[model samples]
Target: MRTVTVEDVTIGEGLPKLIVPLVGQTSEELIKESEFISQLPCDIVEWRVDFYEKVLDFSIVSSFSKTIKKAIKKPLLITFRSKKEGGEKELPTEQYFQLYQEIIQNGQCDLLDIELFMPEKEVSETIALAHQKGIKVIMCNHEFHHTPSMEEILSRLQKMQDKNADICKLAVMPNTPEDVLTLLTATETMYREYADRPIITMSMGALGMVSRITGELTGSSATFGSAVKASAPGQIPIGELKEMIETLKLS
Candidate 1:
């Protein structure tokens, strides 16, 4: 069976990378949204579960998981981002960890993304468990405030690598054009240094919009775009982003 390998999803390449938004706050709404998203030609659908009203309820999440899998044939990425990572919820760290473990154990997602700052031991355990269950772990870190220096950006990517992540994702907000340049440079450098592992690097915000769409040229394995409303700043609609990527290919 085909799977999302370290460097790419066997099914996700060549096709434009898709970013399905997670906007609904209720289970019914999310189910409806999942059905709606499934009709689109997205490469992946990410359930930003942090926005769900019943995020703490395992049963609700489990039900949503089954429904989403049934509704969408595309790869599903489940993420319950913590407040510290620019997410909406603020569950206790322990509770969040427990929820993450349960999702890995029971949720039917193809990929589970955990933040890099989670307790190291706990995070390692989660990665091991996910691998045991044939789920990919995407270790991610988001710096929503400002872009760090190239060196710092590279360090974060290395940290994710050390966590034995199937894919490494780093996002930062850029204050200046130079900052955006630094993020892309770091992405290129990491791709060259670790050509075996897939790395997703992007700059968020209006100033960094161009970087998000064009990262593929710099060796980024994937880029995110919104299908409905944007989850983050500078997210162009998926349809528009798809057209741009195609245009770039033809150029």
Candidate 2:
């Protein structure tokens, strides 16, 4: 198994973790969010670039990356989620992939998240390009409606692993407590079976909040929380999440 550190925060090896403040669309909003994130105890800071007003402009992203790197010393993960994966934007697939490649080559982000649903050729190329530049690739899948069967979840995880992803992340919507259970069960199963790459598993929405906070128990490498606002449906505030993680550690 390979372990990675972003800004001195080690991920994997059962480390309890925190990722604060999902960034918004506008540069001003991201700047404001960075101020708030600096006040929180977070391990990683993610910029959800899909929300940016000039998302297609590689130069704008490069400039924004410089500002974020200077403002927050934490490890950064840059993501431009497609509309198919529960994000707000709808860029053409080719353009989106090009932008992602450009950011990986020119931006300062430590990690880049590429959705798993992208065409296999494109996904492979993106992963290869990211690796060439020494950037970690997080191959992610998002299910906003409902959790799939444990078998299906494992299949997705394996696919990501086969693609040489440094991390495999899946976020599914849970309609009931049982749905949350399904996600955890799959996380544990994948961890035990694969035991190579790190995996991030979460269930979204109010009903799935527990899975987000306590997923480390089931082998999740990290969890997400809001510093300014949530990118997902059930993200708790950073302060509350920090308290919960502390309590969990003591217990």
Candidate 3:
């Protein structure tokens, strides 16, 4: 897989990148929290704006995101995960599309997360718009119930690559050890077979925590870590994640 540059950060070509999420309720809290997280070992920061109290207000979201951009030196990825995919709140599809469109037009973020489960047309338009503005698009799929077959997972990743996604990401919940193994297998298979840019894959929850720590061996290029709080199920703290990645490299 080739490296994708977002601002000064180059992903997929070095130690697996650690992405921390920002999930604050108010604008002031978000700004203060981002300032603190900026000093961590985070290579990328994702703003999970679905958790924000004023997410529906375009001005507030954009302003607060720009404030974070100024506060953090690492690359910023604006993400509004949908409620269907284990997000904090529900977002109607049309409203979701419009919000992302506006954000991409603003050009504040280095990357954007567009869920693959969204309507194809909506996803396509967002991808096209982001690419046109030179903003990297992270096409993502999240399945919190069960891990799909390796074939299905690979196919979904291939679809994201076909759609011109700069990165393809998938997170699934594992019910057993075999399910975690399946996720790792699918991640390696997808990166070997279909990945062109970069791939971020992990199985969520305690049983699947190993996936987050083993990305260097699994061919994944990035993993999530907690900053102020963990947005996902199996995120390790940023400090611990950094130490683990370093240990993995030395081993």
Candidate 4:
């Protein structure tokens, strides 16, 4: 698989990289969280803009991106996760595209997360803009209710790859053990057979937490961990998650 280097961190080349998410509601809270996360042992930090009180204002969101970048040493990954995908806020489709466009042009974040289900033209255009500005795109799809079939999982990932995304990510809420297995099976198949770029996959919630730590085996290039609070269910704390990844590291 191709590796994506953000600053000095090279994902997809070693143990799955740990990504800590900041879910603060205001600039002060996000800055405080960024300072704390900078002291933690993780490869990247994600600011979930949907949780921010001023996310709908493109200028304020761009300003916070700059502030958070200064507050953290780790590479920043900005995500304005849509409420359709279990996020805290919902943005109008046009506003959503505009927010990302502003951020890409502002050039503060090292990476950006774009939902895979957005309008095809807009998704491709935003990704291209990020690339032109030297930002890696993590094309993502979240199944918050239930896991899709292995074929469905692979199809989504394949579409991401075709879009020229630097990384492909999928998170599924597994209702049963079998659903977790389906997620892993799709990830492993993608990594071993089809993927030319890095991919991250997780079967979410307590029932499927095992999938988060087994990335080295299942071929996920990174895993999300929580610092102050988890943006998603089943996110292990960064400290424990780091230890777990190290313990399971393949020699």
For each candidate, what TM-score against the reference? Answer: 0.93, 0.95, 0.97, 0.98
| Model 2 stretches with alpha carbons more than 4 Å out | none
Rank by lDDT (best first): 4, 3, 2, 1
Best model number under TM-score: 4
Q: Tens-digit lDDT track for model 4 on 1-251?
A: 67999999998998999999999997888888999999999999999999999887898888778889988988999999999999998899999999999998874999999999899999989988898888999999999999999999999999999888899999999998999999999999999999999999999999989999999998999999999999999999999999999999898
How would you encode candidate 3's per-residue C-alpha lDDT over 17-67 as one tens digit per residue?
989999988878888888899899989999998999999997767766778
Model 2: lDDT to the true structure: 0.84
- Tell me the lDDT of candidate 1: 0.80
Worst 10 residues of 4 by lDDT: 55-64
RMSD of each: 2.7, 1.4, 1.2, 0.8
Return the TM-score for candidate 1, rounded to 2 decimals.
0.93
Which should have the higher TM-score, number 3 or number 4? 4
Of candidate 2, the 10-residue stretch with the lowest lDDT total is 14-23
lDDT tens per residue, model 2, 89-138: 89998988888877887778888898888888999998898888888988
User: Who is ahead in TM-score, 2 or 4?
Assistant: 4
Q: All models: lDDT? A: 0.80, 0.84, 0.89, 0.92
205, model 2: CA deviation in Å?
0.8
> Model 1, poorest ten-residue lDDT window?
1-10
